[model samples]
Target: MSKNNKEREVTAGPVKGEFISPQELNDIEERTDALPPQEDFWKPPVRFGSVPVEKEPLGWDRRRGFRKLFPVVSLPTQVVERVSFGHPELEPNRLFWGDNLHVMRQLPSESIDLIYIDPPFFSGRQYNVIFGDQNELRSFSDIWEGGMPGYLIWLNARLYEMKRLLKKTGSIYVHCDWHASHYIKVEMDKIFGYGNFINEIVWCYETAGKSKKTFSRKHDVILLYSKTDDFYLDVSKSPMPRKRNKHMRVGVDENGREYEEKTDAKTRKVYRWYFDEGRLPFDYWTDIQFINWEAKERIGYPTQKPEPLVERIIKVSSNDEDVVADFFCGGGTSLAVAQKLKRKWIGCDQSRVAVALTADRISRLIEEEIGKIFSVPDFTVEHWGIYEADRLSKMPLDQFRAFILRAFGAVPDDSQTGIHGMKGAIPIYVGEPNQRSQVTAKEVEAFANAIRKTIRYQQDNLRDGIMLAWAFRPDAVQAAERLRDMEITDLNFVRLEQIRIDHPRFREHVAALSTDHADYANFLTFVQPPKVEVGWKRLATRSYIQADINKRTY
Candidate 1:
């Protein structure tokens, strides 16, 4: 976290203006006197029963971890936009703009090879409200309602999903700080298991701040856990620079290469160390520093981390072409590092601004950072629960049709010219992708004829047909009404339902994907992108004379 986001520390002991009044001291004394005892004493041994973490806070609840938590309801994603660097044949990396829990639910289980999440620490409001997004604000409020317990429960559910999403050989790195790292450690143990716990790395950095009353907090804790005991880790992929002590003898080998030798006292054997073969890294890392304001990598994110730090974690845990995921991706440090390392990456953030920033950062990487751009696979900007209706309306005809069909839970068909897909026995015909394009009367008649030609309609006698579009023309509705009335004379017997994209029927399709949890009602929805206009103006420049300022100060 940045210095501006640091919480104002308040001390309890006596200082210049800080004092405990006489009345308050008297009350405290009275309360202390009323206590039964303060002395330490030996008590009788008590027998205890072990309870699994599935039952929660106290482990008494009958419901398990996922059952008690709000389900990450699976929803169809709309490929509203794409960022490609000329490779459409390869699988594109994914960038999701939605709650990560739900996005993870939609991903296949055991797909990710490594995950690094920098979730919001339970520090306070200022730290959690990084983007001021509605989802983040609501989540922080829920976290503070019950204090520590509420925050743990909210995080435990996501951790459980990450565990399920991780491959058996996958590893996870959770970044946090002093505020709630200990509590999170206990909860993570419960979710990932005590045996799976790996390392508790301390990331030390230098910053300009000191506390006179107490020790300054300068480091952050990164908890590492594996999905299973067989997790992959290659230390040689990223090793520290070799260092030698003054006691070691330095000399040159026969090839004139500089080398250092150390004698083993017990065996009286000499061992030589070379500079090219670097030393393995340690759990305590201090070489990497924080991103200063003047640093080019600083992209104005309140809690953005340095790239070198993220690179170390990725290099050790994953191999080339492996999948790396970051559920709480803020300024895209992890994604950019993964890209540079040649790993397939997935990033998700609830804040639209955060997701947009991530896409821009990766786009820059593809264009300028890596000179060999063609090798990089293109990535897609997908929206899960929150959709972009305007973007969808502007997509290509085939793409828009596929989006609507997938949202409607229908299978796409290309056998017929007019028939776009099928929803059970009923045939579906989609209008043009442009929102202004309306369903015409001629199109309705054509869809009816197309449905009648289908084997299901001819043999199964399926008489239902559906036309979905932005809006239907008045004649189109009238045409459907006329078809229903003339059914007695027509042997084909077709009934067409004209539905607008914004109709209640489409909302039902979205709502049908929600879990039993009530909070999921607002889970899947389409919202127009926020309107933003940029303007700039030259400001009057003011100059100050050093002589005049010095004279005035004196």
Candidate 2:
């Protein structure tokens, strides 16, 4: 919601450049005069024998049809590529890079079983990327010009879509902090109904910082709400360690299990506590620790929640293979935990870097957990508001040319003789619209000729030039090679592969693990499956070394 300095300020009354001619104004006045006078035009029509409507909920933004605020750009539907690790028949999970509102709209209603979103908490600050090679410096702003109202509007729109996506028995968990949490709770009550409100979990963690103004804010609020009263919840999955009673001593039962009994002083009632009865987790959580810098699970992402935290939520809310979704999946912690728990997941984030890191992290998890070679959990990577192959093929010549140039980080230059744009003095020429077909030798020769002309006729100093196309024919590659040998012009013909690599839509395929069956078998025999816990320390160290070697070799 934070506005950039370059953003234009919105004003009321009339938009600039919108002018009504005198004749046009006169026509409007004439039309108004022709109509017969009636009752107050703004008054609501009276209804008889209709169900009495209750007063509209207070604090609710009754403005409907706000989807118009965001123009829907037609994006090409990407083909879902399967990259199976263990189960090929299982429905592939999905990872999307776009606004969650648009992505949720595309999903079918009443399909998802569980939804967990850790959206921006209206912190009035920018959450910048702390790690990741590409987007380390990028930041997401939580500031809103309209303040709480604007934040509510933005979140309410997405929550409305999410509610529709949830099944009758589905549940949602919204994570937030003190800022705007009260407002969000009110908005959620209006949307999900107060009757459906569940527990509000307090996730408490220990950190270094302390506030001098008041008590240190050490906990976050996670609001849990179900689509309906009849929702799924397995609290038994997340049990806490039972605390010992100071008033009673341990006694042995008939089953040889330790038990403790305490007599209430006021009520004179005896209560027995067995060691085997696992205690249910309270609404307030402090068992799970926060991700520290030295933790192995730390991926160096800002605000990355610990895996155990999300794992508990997933376990409690969803069954195996149930579809779970995280709209604001910053580092994909929810998606990764869902996958590990054997749940189908859908995650979306606007940051390409976050998506990239999530894909890489998930691939490594698949490798380490499922022990698959050259495989990852099957999932599709998609970009919204970007042209796909089908749409690109149908686009007009000029528009398509412009799109290609812009996608390649170049400006379209019709003024240039042959080059489309200049990328830091390097002339870029977009090949003909061939729809993934090969670029022929004739096309390559024409580009070569243009470069030669620039060097000879224009007296222009040209070091190198590039030709972008769908694919290059063998002869075309040979021609470019021949020209490079002659030193006339160093023309590099870049094909779709290079472009796709540079602008990757899917996670790069992980290298196949070395298939040393005998060695693996020997190690397994020595460690034994039953003793894995005892030997994991040594095994993990060896695995880490192997992974490092593979990283270097690959």
Candidate 3:
């Protein structure tokens, strides 16, 4: 029969394919083509008649949650400086200033014992609150244009890396709210598996406000999950008070401890409950309070979590000396709690203000809390994606001047012709140094002119002016000395040490340079000011002066 004219019969029999006739093969191909399209299949095939080949999509997944995207690429980081506090013998904790996703990817797999992160919720708003210093402001937009899908993609990428860093027996607590809690839970289940989910804790609190349109939303959901089935959790550490049942009779034990006993009505079994043994905490948590504005723990950072909440989690999920981590360490609450609990910690944040606040807060905590017996916690501060010297050299003169001024904690003055900004009462003149050995004579002349102009403009008293550069020529320094002697303005020829002092990792960089130049070593020693503790009574009697002049100079 002709190929097109022949009627191919489809049979439900195993066709041996070792050697088939050409006509039979043609018939099989034709039969396959005649079958319905795979997309039109009624039901997707199940694995082992139970497990699903593909996950069933929730309503949000179909509209906005899951998405198809390329894999995330992690960037490298360079360690800038290591800081040590009261106890220098303990292993230094790590603080990275960069994208947490990239930083977490660089961490060793299965190294972290516990992870607690309070990432930004999809609140569709911008936060631009300044916490510590006047110039230090943390502004970030958490609104996603692609809505839920984009938010999930951004979060899921980090979560994947977080899972890799978590040990098999480690646990993670993800803090979220009603904004995207349902979506977050679904994605977490898809990554960590539903069987490993431990709890969906509801943290309820009583605030002052109420919504008239609906019930007041006062609770946040904390999804707890383990990396594997064999996870570690100490529920005994987080015990709550339990009231005695009315049917139970109170009695004294042999050791004089009070106890209560009751008989089950259905099972007819007797049970003894000790008064000393507190009840285990349920998933609903209401005891912990939020950080109010007047709270001592409040560091002026909005969205700062309470310390007790993190303390309970750390105590329950991890032991002493275990590794703990917080990727979105806003105000460093987790790091502070971890340090107090004697656990090794790693913290990362992209905001410079956050890093600076964390560094300062940790230092103060060591001094006040742990410095009496143990040394302050030793830690390293690292900045990722810093501009190389070559790249910095290529920057425009105005941009370089502004960058140097800002890095040195001085505000750039665009209105003033020669002066960069006023660092305290001193006028700053920044000279351009593009990979040069010394500041040029022309730059020195301009600085002298700027000093003369500033003096003439002020017309009050001869004030000190600072001339900053990478390095100063002997002639330039001599010229500055001459200008200072002239009494027009006391121009001091200082190098970039002033700028380096503001950097968190400046000590390490200065130490590295000190090997080549003994002067750099001396500069490092000169920058270390004497520590002074001031009380309110002293401040009331006299002017409060900060011991660290470098901090106030800016």
- Candidate No. with top lDDT: 1
Which regions of candidate 3 deviate over 4 angstroms?
A: 1-80, 86-89, 130-143, 244-276, 373-377, 387-554
Model 2: pairs clashing at backbone N, Cα or C within 3 Å: none
Error of 1 at 119 (Å): 0.3
Instruction: Please say which candidate is ahead in lDDT: 2 or 3.
Output: 3
lDDT of each: 0.66, 0.61, 0.62
lDDT of candidate 3 over 226-289, digit per residue (tens): 9888999998897766667787898998899888998899999988888788778889888787
Root-mean-square deviation per candidate:
18.7, 18.9, 23.5
Task: Please give each candidate's TM-score.
Answer: 0.65, 0.59, 0.57
lDDT of 2: 0.61
Tell me which of candidates 1 and 3 scores higher on lDDT: 1
Please identify which of the two predictions, 1 or 2, would achieve the higher TM-score against the true structure. Answer: 1
TM-score of 3: 0.57
lDDT of 3 at 321: 88
